[model samples]
Target: MQIKRNTALMVGVLLILAVAAWAVTRPAKPRLAAPTAIPVRVVSVAQQDVPRFISGIGSVLSLHSVVIRPQIDGILTQLLVKEGQSVKAGDLLATIDDRSIRASLDQARAQLGESQAQLQVALVNLKRYKALSIDDGVSKQTYDQQQALVNQLKATAQGNQAAIDAAQVQLSYTQIRSPVSGRVGIRNVDEGNFLRMSDTQGLFTVTQLDPIAVEFSLPQQMLPTLQGLIAAPTRATVDAYLGADTDNQTGDLLGEGHLSLIDNQISSTTGTLRAKAEFSNPAHKLWPGQLVTIKVQTALDKNALVVPPTVVQRGLDSHFVYRVSADKVEVVPVQVAYQNSDINIIKGVQAGDVLVSDGQSRLKAGAQVEVLKEPPQVIHTANAQVQP
Candidate 1:
């Protein structure tokens, strides 16, 4: 039994030694290593004339707007214009019942005719009396009385003529015409509706479409800049944007305008000053009471260091940027001179300096950077090699 156990132990030791030799002699497997450089996209700083603009919410207003109302009390017999129709000044818009006014005018005319006929007869009688008195053929008192009678008839005819003029004025008021060249708004009263001269609500409104105005409000801090623009011989250009856009740099552009005027006083409650700009809206892109976004150019920074907004990052204390130097990046504190939604005018970076625009989340000061201007290089590590 001792001889069999010794033989088995010797065989196990030999097998263990063989397995150790095989493990040591085999080829090592490929292993993974950490990336040496962080992948990032970069941009170069540019020097150019950057226009500085201030943005505000604005409302569109028609330069010429009028509420068409009747001058005389009457029934609106006919409406000659449809809603939203463009009309010129003096274009007939609506008609009132004019039969009563016409009748009054005709009666005044007949009264004037009768009075004039009587006056003509009186004048002829006075002429005859004067001739008779010249020869002493008639009494002087009779000629004087005839002259007085003629004067009285002339007064009656003059009063009747005045009445005819008054009636004619009333007749003209029956035709309601457009007082301004514009587009008509919705009608407040329909045809056959009784209209009173004292009614505050009128038939409709006429608002000028072309050569419109936009009213905007800016903070009082921009007052000086606005004053300079208004006093300039050439008005400052303004741009209006549509919804979700705060400046001319983004979104849909509605129309262009020029600064017209500024309000005399700033609002104490809001700390903002109101301003107005004019635009020739021949296409009717701007309408009355339309809300829009306005961008008013305050100044132009010549040869400004311009960069993408994303290049500048806001830290807990101040703003900073990742400036690329060779293969490494360093954080550089930057001062923003002016910034809009599209670009930023900064002070710390020089023109033509390279900056890391993206992949900043994984980057730190003094970290290596691999510029991702092109596709990343692919490395195919050799599969784990084993040699017998």
Candidate 2:
């Protein structure tokens, strides 16, 4: 019994020693620190042609407009043109009853014919009188009187011819014709209505619709830039847009044309300058008094440094962006050249700098960052890793 007890004690002591050795000499397990994932979004920077532009609201107008009226006092016998019909220059638009004027012209012509015949007879008599005077057969007073009668008859014939010409002109005035090539508006007078040359009101209106003009105003600050653009030898083009509202901006391409006119004085109320641009309007999609938005390319900077607009951020007094440097965020201030939709043309952002597109809002001056081995497709948080 004593030997067994001593053997049992020895085994227990050996097991205890083994436990003590494990407690003293076993390799220490490492303590792991939790990882921090910052939420963010990212987009790669690319080089593209950035256009400089000026945007403004404008209204369309007709370059030429005129009121059509009658030139003779007569009844409206026939209407030759319909409302909204396109007419060419000298096209017959309306006709009036010309019976009185025509009868008067016929009477004058008849009188001219009679006067010419009388003048011929007087000339023959004067010739005979001259022959008689040379032979001393007729008295000098009788020859002189015959010559004076011939002169008087010739003058009367000329005056009658003049009256016939004037009467014919008056008869021609009964037909009203289009003075310009344009679209006709509503007709104010119908057939059988008496019209007079002295009528102060117009019978109809015609507007030259094709090749329309779009009038727009630009801020006074844009004058310098516009002058510089105009000074260049090459002519610049402008585009016009029309839509239901400002949001649903639809651009109807009124074909490109030259800048026709610029107002001499600036508007004091709006602090803007008025300008006019002409369009080809081949399809006639543009009309008079149509509202539109104007976009003009002012200039192009060939050497401008540019980046995505999403990377730009506002600083206290200027704009800045966060760039990746040695696995850390570096905020840099940038002077912007201009913004074209999704891209921004800048002066300070370099070509090779890795810009933090989404995490810029959360980044401090220097924050440690790790580029994920597999970039996330969707980043919801502010400090998440952003993919380039």
Candidate 3:
């Protein structure tokens, strides 16, 4: 039994030794394949003149707006202008019932005529009295009494003439005329409606459409910059957009104008300053009380280095961009001088340097990159040009 045990142990040891020798002699596993190059889009840096603008919300206003009101209390007999009709200053807008005014004027004229007839008689009597007093044909007391009576009649004639003048002046107010040149708004009173001079709501409104104005507010910190523009020889230009979107990529432009005025005091609660601009609105596109976006060009930077806004990346400590060179990308730090919705003005990168615009997540320092070329745009041509 002992001899059999020793033989079995020797066989087991030899089998283990053979297995270890095979494991040591085997070939090593193949190395992992290298990572594929990341696909990216790149754009070359560009240098150009950039404009710096201050943006704010603005409201459209009319340069001349007036509420048409009746000067005298009377029934509105006729409306000469329809709603939304353009009219010039002093144009007939509406007519009030003038029959009552005309009658009052006639009465005043009749009173003046009666007074003049009496004054004529008084003049003749005064001449007779003077002759009698000179010749002593009558008593001095009687002549003096006649003279005083003539003077009283003359004063009554003057008072009647003054009443006639006042009546004529009031008659002129019966015709309602436009106070300014503008388009008419909705009517507050219709024909046959009695209007009063003290009515809070006027008959209608007229607002000047051409050469309109826009009011806007900006932060007080920008006051110095705005003052500089105002002090310049040429007036600074202002642009108004339709919507509140200040982003140039999406906002629609309404019109352009020149800076007109600035409020003397700033609002303490909001820390903002108010300003106004005047625009020639021949098309009447801008309306009163319309909210819009305004851009005021305050300064211009000559020969600024610009890049696509997407190329810039924010980091923990600073901003960065992946600069492409020789099919490799390197993380380059950049200082952003100014930025708009579309592009950014940078100072760290030089002009003509290529930058990666997309696919930045898989990038590392000195990482290999595959630049993607954009598909060519298809253009349509006229048949005549194509034939040639």
Task: Judge candidate 3 at residue 101 and give its lDDT.
Answer: 80
Q: Model 1 misses residue 291 by how many Å?
A: 1.4
The candidate 3 region of ten consecutive residues with least summed lDDT is 379-388
Tens digits of per-residue lDDT, candidate 2, 1-388, equal 9999999999999999999999999999988977464555554444444455566788899888889878778899999999999998899988889899889888888888998898899889888988988989899999999888888888888888898889888877888888888999988888989898888777898899877898999888877766766677876666777763222235555556556667888999989998888888877877888888776666555644556567789888999887777677777898876664445667676665667776665678777766554463331211111111
State how far residue 227 of model 1 sits from its true place (Å).
1.3
Please write out the lDDT profile of model 3 over residues 3-113, one tens digit for every residue. Answer: 999999999999999999999999999999997889998887887776767788999999999998888999999999999999999999988888988898899889889
Q: Can you tell me which runs of candidate 3 are displaced by over 4 Å?
A: 1-5, 8-36, 114-158, 375-388
**lDDT of predicted model 1:** 0.85
Pairs in clash, predicted candidate 1: none
For each candidate, the alpha-carbon lDDT, in order, equals 0.85, 0.75, 0.84
TM-score of 2: 0.76
- Candidate 1 lDDT, 108-143, residue by residue in tens: 899989989999999999999989998998999999
Superposition error at 333 for model 2 (Å): 2.7
| Residue-level error in angstroms, candidate 2, position 43 | 3.0
User: Candidate 1 regions off by >4 Å?
Assistant: 1-40, 125-150, 247-250, 310-323, 328-335, 358-368, 374-388
Alpha-carbon deviation at 354 in model 1, angstroms: 1.7
* C-alpha root-mean-square deviation, each candidate: 11.1, 10.0, 6.8
TM-score of each predicted structure versus truth: 0.75, 0.76, 0.82
